[model samples]
Each structure stands twice: as C-alpha cells, then as structure tokens.
Target: MPCAPTLAHYWLAETLRLREALWGPLEDSGEVRRARAQGQGFGQKVLLRAQFLGQREKLDLLIARWTRGARLALLGMLAAAILAGAATAVGALGDGSRSVNVLLALTAMLGLNALAFLFWLLSFAVRSAGSGTWLGELWLWLTRKLARGPDAALAPRALVEVLSRNNALRWILGGISHGLWAAALLSMLLSLLAVLSARRYGFNWETTLLSADTFVSLTAFLGWLPSLLGFAIPPEAVVRASNGLQALPETAQALWSSWLIGCVATYGLLPRMLCLVLSLLMARRNLAAIGLDENLPGYAELRGRLAPPSEKAGIDGPDTPGFQAHFRPRAPAPHDQTQPLLAGIELAPDTPWPPAGLPAGVADLGIIDSRLERKNLLERFQRQPPGQLLMVCDAQQTPDRGTIALLAELAGLAGQAHIALHGQAGAGFSDARAAAWQERLAAAGFLPGQLHAGLAPALAWLAAGQPARPIAKDAHVQP
Candidate 1:
C-alpha cells in the first residue's frame, strides 16, 4: 500500500491547525476573497484563502484534489517499467543462447537492485538536516507545478519551509522508489514466463576461466537462502552438467530454468516486495513525526497573536472590516530620561557606523553583525541594557527571517525598543520596499511602523524614549 495520500493529508491537517493558531485563519468572507483575488501568485492566494480552512477541511480538500494526480504519477512510472521489462525479457531470449549466464542474470537484476538500495541508504545516513534530497527536489518541483495558482508564489516562506520539512515528501518518494523496482521486476518475470512458454529451451553455462566445480559450489552457495524457504537447490550433477557450448539434457535444462526463475522471484522480486511494504510502513511512521517547528523566527513570534483579545487590539481602518486585529502600543511615558544608545543590526559595511548626530550625552552602544557579536551584546546588556536602544538597519536591505529573529532577540534587552531604518532615498531603495520591511517588522512582533527612514527622527525617537512614527508612505525622509 502507498502512503502518500495518508501522510500528506495528516501533514496538511497539522499545518492547518498550526497556521490558524499562529497566524489566524482567513475567514471565508469578502475581505479574504478580495485580497486573494488581487494577489498575483499562488503563494499569495494560498496564504490569503487557506486562512479560512479548518484543519480537517483542508486535509479533505487536499486529498480530493491531489489523490488522482498521485495515482496518475504512479501509473506513468509503471508504464516506464513495462517498457524496461520488455527490453530485459528480449535480452533473455537471445537466439543462440538457450539460457542466460546465471552470474550475468544475477548481476543484471539483483546486483543492480542492491547497489541502488545501498546508495539510498547511504544518502539517508550522510545527508544533513534542512538540506533536500534529489527526490525531495523533484517532489518540491512537482508540488509547485501542481499547486500553482496565480498567487501561490506570494505564500510566506515560513509556510513553504514547513511544507518542505514535512516527512510526507520522503515517504512518497520512498514508496515511488520501491514501487518502481517492484513493478519492473514483476513485469520482467511475466515477460520471461511468456517467452519460456513459446520455446523448448536448453540451459547451458559457458565460462572461459572457471572450472565446472567452481559453478557447482557457486550455485549451492547462491541457492542456500532460497533453499531455506523451500526453493530447491540444484543437484550437483545438474549444476556440473553445464559443459561449455554442450547443452544440458532436457531434464537438467528444465531444472536450471526453474532455479533461475526461483532466484529471480526470491532474491530479486521478494526483497523489493518486502521493501515496498516497508516503505509504506515507514511512510505511516513518518506521518506521525510531521509536526511544526514553532521555534522558527516566522512561527515563533506569532505567539503574541494567540494572546487573549484586548481593547488595545489595533483595528484596521474602518474600510477593511475583518482584518486581523493588531495591538496598539502606547508610548512610554517620558520619565526615566537617561541618554539612549544606538546599535546597528548587521548594517552594510559601506554604510556609516554609529550614525552621527546623537544628543551630546547619547552613547554608541556598538554594531552587532555576527552571531558572536550578538552573544556578546546580550551578555553586556544583561548587566546594563540601554535605556532606549535604537536598533538600526539599512532600508536598502531586505528584512529576512534571520534579521527578524535577531531583532526580536535584541528587542528583549531594551528598556524600550525603537527600530530605525535609513538609505530609503539612496539608489535602489524605494518607498514600496521600505513599506514591505515595515509590514515584515510588524509581523515579527516589532512595533508597527516604528522603522525610521532618517537619522534625525531615529535619534530623536531614541532620545525621547517612545515608539517612533511610521515612515511617510509617499516620500522618502531625508537623513
């Protein structure tokens, strides 16, 4: 039995629940529909619309839509196996040779199969975490192709990362590998039977280097395992009867054919059949392990959203009704009026460090670019965190998950956190880009629209010990 459908459905359900709890669901209302409609790619559409689905409902929808496609993929692989089987069977029925070289047949069938299996096992052993396998790459490509919607590309990276890490892909690919081998072997056996039916074939083994006794011992050793399972071991007389080019008598011939067929079924097909079953079992097991990593910066910070509702919930403008309620941050009272400090969060090397024009009493805490620097910054701040820390970054830089994670960590040490952004008016930085960064910052649990575009306001905001105002959407603020 294949486990893709079962595993994928389970994974989908888990993801749906986590996403809903963390990000909230998209209600099936005009607001979501309009947003989804306006979205440009499947990513955007999925994020917008999937917010509406209950855990079970999403699973049902996914299975109903993708199950047929999965079956079709399997069928296509089966068709390829049939072609390979026909080719192998044709090679088996060579005109002059009455039988295949038992060594050659073993090498071609079981040897090749064992080699491929070993490769997969080795890969499983040596592969790193968060790194994708070849099968996973293909699976991801297929997923993107199949799941393609106009807005799908706009889906959150966090969601994509979760989908990739799910064990369902591994299970599906494992099943496919086992199924491919089993189908090819079954078809090859059937083809061998068809050819053997049409001819009275004599079995003979020809070897230039080996003596007859060598083959007798080889045959006995090879048949030992199958013999334990009731498959007959050839008599020594029958094995030694393989005098080169002098064909074995009909009785010996029939026996050799039976031995060959038994080996193919037992050594070749049986192992693959067992593997296919095991893959399905493993697939089921993998399904149980497919849970979300809430520690990821994207999912980690969403915890605040799950907090109980409060009047402090910031309402979206009256025009957009059903938008997720955001909490409003009240300005800290201007009381503990100590001079603040400024630090850059991995600001670009070319950009000015410890940006000038702070109040005479203000201090330049330091720049934190590497993980070590962050650690040191934290330790030093543990003793004396800045009264109001100005966490600065370049507006020209993209706000990635790493940046958010770092900002979130740094925000924890500040008496009050005021985020500052510069370089908006510089070459390659646009107002739209700055706005996107603001949204990302907000999602990462930073003060919404608190990013500053100019050094003056950022410095002023830091000195004032209050949340900064939103960067102007229409014009870039000059530093």
Candidate 2:
C-alpha cells in the first residue's frame, strides 16, 4: 500500500535498526563474548548473540535496531530513481504521448522493479546460505577464499536451536522485511508510472499517485488483516476446519471461500517456514566454512612427553631385546586389557606362514610386501576376504612371476584368498590375462569391492581404519 519502494525503505531501515539495537549493545558489552564462544562459526555467533539480546532487554533494543535501519532508506530511494529513469526512457522510445507512451513507461518500470526484486531475493539467499547469521562468512564462501570440510554430514543442531529460540517474533520481523522489499519495488514502479503519465499523456500526477496509493493501501490492509488472523489463529483449528470441509459437498461459494482460506494460510505460514529453513542451512554452511567439522586435538600439553630419551636409557632401542636391559617394564594393572600383543615369527617354505612362523596368541602381525606380491594378493583377494592380513606384494597393474608366486603362497595359506592389484586401468597385464584372472576368481566366488582410484582418498580411508565387516556390509558403502 505504501508502494513497494517506500515499504522496502521502511523494512531495510528497520532491519538495520534491529541489528544495531539488539546486537550493537551486546557487542558493546561483554554479553556477546559468551554467545560468541558457544558458536563454531559467524552464523552461530549471530544467533547466539540474538538469543542473548532477547533475554536482557526488549524495547530499547528494538528502537535502536530501527534507528540503524533508517540508513537503508537511501538505497531504496536509489532503486526508485533507477525505476523512474527506465520509465522515462521507455516513454521516449514509444511514440511519445500520442499513443500508449505512458503505459509503456509503466510497463518498463514494472520490468525494472521485477529485475531489482530478483537480485534482492538472490542476495538474500546467498547471504543467509551459511550456518550462522554472520553474513560476512557466507560472502567468503561465495568467493571461495575458504575451503570448508564436507557440508553433507554437518550437524543441524546449531540451526535448529536458533530457529526454535524466538521463531514467532523472528518470522514476523522477517515477513515485514520481505514485505518492505516488495513494497519498495511496487512504490518505485507506481511512482514512475504516475510521473510518466503526467508528462506524456497530460494526466494529473497528484490524482494518479493519490488514487494508486489508496488502492494499494487498501489491498495491503486486506492482505495484512487476513495474514495476521491466520497467523494468530491456532494452527490446529485451521487444520480441523480444513479437514471437516473435506466431507462436505462443495458449492462454488464454499470452494472459493476455502481457497481463500488456503491462500491466507499459505502466505501466513510460508514466511516462517522459509526463515527457519534458511537459518538452518546458513548455519550448517557456516559451520563447515569455519572448520567446525574437523577433529580438533585435545587441550592437554604433551610436548614434554614427546622428548627423546635422555641419559637414563642404556641401549637406545629399549623396546627390543638388544635395548631391553636399559628399561624396566612398569607394573601393569591386573584388569588392564591394553597390553601390546607379543609375537615371534619364523618363515619356512615347508610349513605355512601362519602356523609355522607366527607365535601362538599373537594379537596381530605387521607385514611389508614387495610390489609384485602386493599386486598378486590384491588380485586374488579382490572380492573375497584374504583370510589373514595377506600382504599383497605385486603391482596390481604389472603382475610379475614373483608377485604370482606370493599370491600362490597366500592362496595356499588361505583357501579363499584373492589378488588385490594396484596398476593403471589397462597397463600392467594383457587384457586377456586380466579377464581370465577375473573370470577364474568369479568362478571361485571371490570378487573385488571398490578399488583405489587415486592414491589420496584410498590412503585416507585405509588410514582411518577398515570396516569391521566386509565392505558390502559396511554402512559407509552405498547399496
């Protein structure tokens, strides 16, 4: 009703005012410090700060926020000026006032307003895209200066907490802001039309503006009333009424009235829902933007513990037999289950490695493989379990005789072992040989799961630790 441009000015000014009043005071004082600490990123900080502001003071904060918001009115005016100029240009481009010059101008103004509105909407989304209210961080993400960790798995609690804190008031204000933008755009268009009509078609500017203002104001009033009523009425009551109408035969009037009610609900509820969703998504992105997802180290100061062994040590390698005389084992707690597994090994071709070499009761063994054996082992164990921690000693791409021999030994040691190759897609072996080996393994009931593609992700996953069960059974694997 106030015209879109005027409304935009009002809302932008109001938002800035609210931000300054609510956030400014807290920032000035120390209350923001605690709030800041609670957040992982800028968005969280703003949300926490807002929550804190809500608790301490109310009226003064609101007034201050609006005071700061007044500045944005200037921007709204600039937008209005742009719209006016476009309207004039369109009027001139058309056959001057003789035909539909005035209408052309109005149409051009509307188009300009629409473009401006589009940009405003996009900017809103971009600014609020991160995990927190600190718009600056989101800006950084847009610019790609900061590379955040995976956004997909980030937690949503920070967002949820913020949205749930002051949802009703928050959404009301957010709707007002949106309405303001809409109004400003409309105002600019309306004003441009009035000015162009007066100049081109001898229409009275004052009368046109006054009439348009009255019409728009009345429309705004109607919209505002219904929206307010819908929001004020309990959601359950509306839902119940909607449900009851489902059983009744629909008259045209009844259908139209129901449709009107539905529209009211949509407009009233959509703003709140959008705000909540935007807040959450922005918070999530912000969290990732600030490295919140990383595994930060513990706070304990362990630098002293990591120093090299001093004069107290006899042989340097006290953990081994040659150095064992220098060190005495600390007495262990009877209940402790963390003792390192002691092991001894001896290898002979006559006997199997596991039974012949490995000491009984050893918890685990660490084996190094030659590239060939590693490749052969991978190929053999591709789809099946290697039974033991079979170290493949072959290059998966280039399988040699030595690697084949290692695989054969592993196959003997474990009845169901398969090779795990590490080679380029079509490099190491003849296609026929590779196909034959794959077919042989397929017949033997062994198949490869996902193989390493590039070195990094593969190594990272392996370093993180393998799944307890077969990869297919692992939740991390896709169906």
Candidate 3:
C-alpha cells in the first residue's frame, strides 16, 4: 500500500488538479491506471499518480521558492513594524523638551490600534472576512512579488483555496496579523521604557473647552485597570495642577510616567498578545481538520478514473493463448572492452536516478528516455564499448519488441553484458513482468546467470569483476 498523504502531498495534488483545470489535461503514460491498480485509496492514488508522473521535483522547486519568498516577506514586515513602533514611541514623547501631554500621548499611542482592534473583532460577524487585515494582505503581496515567475502564483492560489474551502483562511491570516501587531506593540513598549528611564519628562493634560475635572475623570477611568495590575494612578491634585505648561514635581512626574506605561501595556500590548494566541489556536484547530476537497472542479473527474465501478464478467469466446519461449540464440558480437557502465532504460520519471551504492569505477549513463539519447548511447558504445554493461529495465513496463532489440544490440557491443529488472518483486504484476523479461533476454542469447532480478546482483557481479561461478549450458534462469 502507498504511504499516507501529508499536507505537502495534498497541496501538490491539488495544485496539479488546478493546473489541469486551467491548462489542458496532462499527458498520462499509464500512470493513472497503474496508480489505480497499486494504491489503496483516493488520496494514496492521487499521490501515486503524481509520483509516477514525476511531479515531485517540480513540487519541490515550487515549495522552495515559496518558502524563500515567505521568509523574505516576514523579515521585511518585521523590520517595517519595528521602525514604525520606534517612531510612534518617539513622536509620543516629542523630544522630551516640554511637559508631555498625557492625554495626547495616550491617544497617539493607542487611538489607531484601538480602531484596528475593533475592526478585527467585527470581522468575526462578517461573512467575507477572509481577506484578513492590511498587514496580512501586504505580506501576501510581498511574498508573491518576491517569488514572481510564470508559475509563481499557482502555489499561493492553491494554498488560499485549500484554506478558504476549510474556513481556515481567516484564522490563519488573523494569526499572522495579530502576531505582527504584537511584535510592534512589544517594540513600542520597550522603546517607551528605555526613553523614559533615560529622560526627565513631566506629564500634564490641557484642554481649551473641557474642564480639569473632565481630564481627571478620563485619567481615572483609563488608569483603573492598570492600577489593579500594580501600575500607579495619578491623584486628582496632580491631574489638576499639571493642566498647564509648568514643570511638575518629581512625585507627579513619576506617577504620570507609570500611568503612561501602564495604559500602553494594558490597552495596546495585552490585547494584541491575547488575540495572537487566540488566532493561533483557532488556526491550528481549523488547519488540522483540513483535507483534500475532492469536490473541486478537476477532482470530480478523477474519481471515475482512479476508482471505477466493478462489473460482472463471463467468458464468451475461446481461451487466450499461453506464453511460448521463442529462443533464437545467436553468436554474441565482439567489440573492444573498456570500463564497466551502468545505465537505466525508460525508467519511470519519479524513479531515483543514478541510484546509490554503485561500486567505485562504474560509469553511470543516466536514464535513456528519448530517441536521441538512445542513439547517442549506442554511438558512444560503438566507439568505446564497456568491458561489462549492466542495463537496468523497469520491471513494471512490458518487454516490447523495440526494448528487446535494444537490449540485444547493447549486449552485442559489450564484452559481457547483464540485464537487471529494476523494481520491487512484490509490486503488482512485477513478478510476471520479471519472468517475461527473463524469457525475452534468454531468447536473445543472454545466459541464465547473466539475468539479475535487480541492481544489487548486477553491482555484485561488477564488483566481483566476473560471474561468481560458471553457468552450465542447460541451466534455467530464475526471475
């Protein structure tokens, strides 16, 4: 059975499905049929199809690009937020020259933040709040911009569609927005504490139309929560006396400073921190529930192809013919012997290339896929034949006339050649396919000891510098 699907597998399969919808259908060289036969479920079949079609490498590239772009976008946003926070803190204190306007400072620090927080709260009631906050949108825009290419938008589009279909987009983006805001607020708090510790600044409130009692009441109301948290609250006298430009006593200044810090912490930082945690939890829960949306436009068509209905069958004609070994052994060709070479012929796209564990000096002529590549290899073999040639064939594919002929020709060029059937012995039709290859190669004059079930024996043969023992003339080959 195929392995369980992961988030990346879902993303890759969904992206490919969407691409098929946008572009025309992808060419299938029996991959879907093989996947249906080998895989145990819809998810596994989809993943198998992608692997057989060699889409994993493309998916890896796309994922790498997205990760790099996201990191850069995050760094950029963080730098901007830090700068903005520092600037806000500096602007609130106004160079520390005159008595700081406590009311104005409070408004400057939190008025916009409060408005933004209220908007975020209201987003829960809105149906189309998946657009998220401005910061989240900006991050997305920057990420896409940094990863610009022909296929750049495909990944992000697929991710958004997947998250949005599961109603996880808002929470995910909300978490990002809240986290960034929290970072900014923390930076502001730190900057405020640093500047206040270094400077001797007084705090006062002035109003042209409002009375001192109004400032006192407003200050009391705002400081109430902070006071409960051990932050100092200014007395009515301090609030009354600091209504002008006159410098206040040290006790009044200390109280005003504590109040300012407390209010910023209570109102600005705490709310963002709480929302950040909430968004993260909600996002995680929703994301954990996400799965492949098989009802999407392209996925509906795959159900029939990947899991077709069963049908009753009856024999209505004569039995088909059985296998017959048409052995036409001919004298092997002679050629100049050189280094040993290992090569793969028409292997599946997703099969690992230049496979590992090769002995020291065997030259790996990578997988021969196209006609030009085959012709080139044949010409190179003609010019300088290998002393021992190990040709790897995909056991999953049937041995056709062309493949048999090519194997024969390559065997004729090498001083001694061995054919290795490459695949798992227990996979669907693998044993039958391997037996077919054995019969075909034997018919082509390859000795029984020269046929290997897989690459390990071939490598062992190469490493031994020859066959382990002499083969009897009438010996039978085991697949």
Candidate 4:
C-alpha cells in the first residue's frame, strides 16, 4: 500500500532526529537576526533558519497545511485521468486511422506533461505558503498539543534557524533514489504481465510446447519415461532449480525489454549521489558560517563532547533569554519604510567581502612573533590593557613609539580588549573588523583557548602588562 499518513509523519520525524544527532539543530533567534544584519543572502538566511528550527517541525507544518484535503486533490486527479481516457476513446471512435491517431498520441504525451506540471506547481505553492510566519504559528500550536516526549527535543545545530535551511541537496538525492527503485520495479512488473498475455495467446506454431524427445519406442515407454524422470529427482530440487532458472530468464527479459530503465538507473543515481555528497559539504559550510570550526581543528573536530573553543570565540552572546526560540518572518513593508539594516554592505550582485588578513600584533604572543618582526614596539603597549589601547587607537591616527608600523601601533592599543563578534558579514576584514573576530582568529590557526597554543598566552600576557615577543613569518598562518 501507499505510505499511510501516520507512517510518513513518523518517518519524517525520525529522519530529522537522525540529522540532529549528527549535526545539531540550527540556532533560531539571535543568530538569524545577526546573520541578516551582517548581509547574508536570502538562501543563506533560509538555510540558517532551517538549522535553527530543525526540519521536522517545518516539514510537518508544511505538509499538514499544504496537503490538507489531499483526498479531495486525489479525486481531482482521478477525474482528470477519467476525462483523459474518455477523450482518447472519443477520438479513436471518430477517426482511429489518421487525425484521431495523431490527436491521441499528442494528447497522451502532452496531457501527462501538463498534469505533472500542474501537480508540481500546486505542491510548490503549498509548501511555500506553509513557510515563514505561518509555519512558526503552526509549530507552536503543535508543540503545545504534542506533549514533550524524550524524542521530541532534537539536538540543534548552532547555525540553522529554520526548516528551510536543511540541506536541499540531500532531500533531492533521497527522492531520486526512491523514484528510481519504484519506477524500475513497476516497469519490470508491467513487462512481465505483457509477456504472460502474449504467451497465453499461444506461441508461433513452429515453437515446441515443451519436450524435444526423439524416442522411437512405443507409447508404453513414454508413460514410463515421466515416472522414471520424476522419481530420479527430489520434488523440491526440481521446483527450486526450475524457479531459479525461470528467474534468470525473466530478469534478462525485463532488462532487454526497456533501455529507459537502464538509462534512468544510471543517470538518476548521479544526482542522488551528488546530493549525498552535497549534504556533507553543506554541513561543513554551515558550521563554518557560524564560526564553530575556528574553535576546533578541522570540521571533524565538532564530533565529540570536547569543551567549546572559548566564551570569546563562540557564537552565543551573554544573553540566555534568546536561546531555543525559532525564526519568524519580518513584518510587511510599510509606507516610507526604512531600508534593510545591511543596505550599505551591497551583499548581492557584488559581495563586499574584504580579504582575510590579520592586523599586526592583534595578539602579542609568540604567535605573531612567529609571523612578523615586532622590533621594540611590543614594550609601548604592555603598560595598558588591549581594551583601553584599542579605544584610544580608534581615535588616533599615529603614535611615536619604536616603529610607525601599523602592527606595532595596533598591538600596543588592544592589549586586553574583550569583544563579542556576532552577525555574519558578506565580506572579510581584520579579525576585529569581521563579524566574529575571536572565532575567525581561531579558524585562522590562532588557538584562542589552547593553553599550549602561544597566541592566547601572548594576548593574556599583553593584557597583564607584559611585553610581547618579536614577530616572525610563518606559512601556516595564511588561510
């Protein structure tokens, strides 16, 4: 039977739970708001939102709302099918030889295409309508109605903010896989039915019914021949061997019957496999988007229960009230409405991302010393915290210290600076100038929380009124 509604719902919920177990749910409220402010594109925003809410609630809301009266919709489909069949019959009755034949052939092809197009359009509209604010309300209502079972809370991704953000590539791949299996099996069965019908009509007179015996002995020997052969083999052996042999021919027949199945199975699997690969790629991309990878090593670093990078290097702000909330749509545009917060960024058509480069002495440890020559400039900024120094540097254009170099001057000013980097920028800049400075630093090889890592210790030393080591150059520092 076709999948029952309840079964489909459970399957969707289970799949979402699996995703959450592997990648965490999207961060819904603050992160999305920050992402929007930072000039993330619409697709990015949608994906971020999906990560936050997890796709289950989104899928449920979408299917429940849009697929309402699905039974009624099926009735419409059946009616269309009946009308199609009648049209074919009427045309055939009128002139089966020429005009009716052409008309029937065209209708068979074009009418099916039209029907498919209509169904797809309708489904897309329904899914779209179930998105944004409407979905949020529906989700809230469902959450209240369905008691909080242990399985209800899926682990969320820190990046995603809504169901729309779930990897579309993965979904498409899975659908293609299923479609292939179904179509292949259906065609095989249909071919078998046609073959059986042809067989029943009787084979060509020249073909034998069964036996190829050339015995010249009398009828008495023929009657004994059947019993002798039957007794020679066990009943089960004959049946099993015959069944296996039959299956081989049937399979061969099915394979030979249609090249369409072969082409589809081969070509269709490509998109499905591609989708699977994209799902993994997207997971890594989404993680990078939120600055999580900076705190860890590679993308694989997020797997275990290791302590998170650091308070400064993480995505969350100090506010706990914003946790666990899902995304909602922006309000309708108003007369004389203000431009979007990120208007100056010019995110689309042309992205304004800055080059990924660090300012000198942003951290005063051996890390920078390992990358550039510091000269004697480290001593001048050791007297004050980085916070005080940067605030002062923000105002002044020059300082008469050891060197007039940009690195030395800035290093002196930001000795003990503490800042929160939220929002997503369409461009890149110095770590401090980027959306999440500390996270970006970690990602770029400055281990902010690793005690053995020299960068954090140097920044700490600078904060504690101590001089920084001289800078050096290293190939590892570049992204």
Q: Which candidate comes out best when scored by lDDT?
A: 3
Task: Give per-residue CA lDDT, model 4, range 1-479, as digits (tens).
Answer: 12222223323334343544455552332333332433244433333333333341464444343234333443443444445444533332243232112223323423443443244336545654232222123333343334233433332211122232443322332232233323433343344334433542111001134321211121123224334433121122222322222232343323222222232223333333453465446545543333112222222332221222332222432223222232232223223112111001111223222212323334322212211223223333333223422111110111211111222233223423221112232334232332132233333222232111123333344344344342222211111
Candidate 3 lDDT tens digits, 295-321: 777777777667768522332122222
TM-score of 4: 0.20
TM-score of each: 0.51, 0.20, 0.66, 0.20
Which stretches of candidate 3 lie above 4 Å from their native place? 1-4, 51-57, 310-479
- Name the candidate, 1 or 3, with the larger TM-score value: 3
lDDT of 4: 0.30
Clashing pairs in 3: none
lDDT of 2 by residue, 138-213 (tens): 2222223222223211112222222333332223233334443344444443443454445432211123244444
lDDT for each residue of candidate 1 in 191-213, tens digit (9 for 90 to 100): 77777677766666678898999
- Compare candidates 2 and 3 on TM-score and give the better one: 3
| Candidate that would win on TM-score | 3
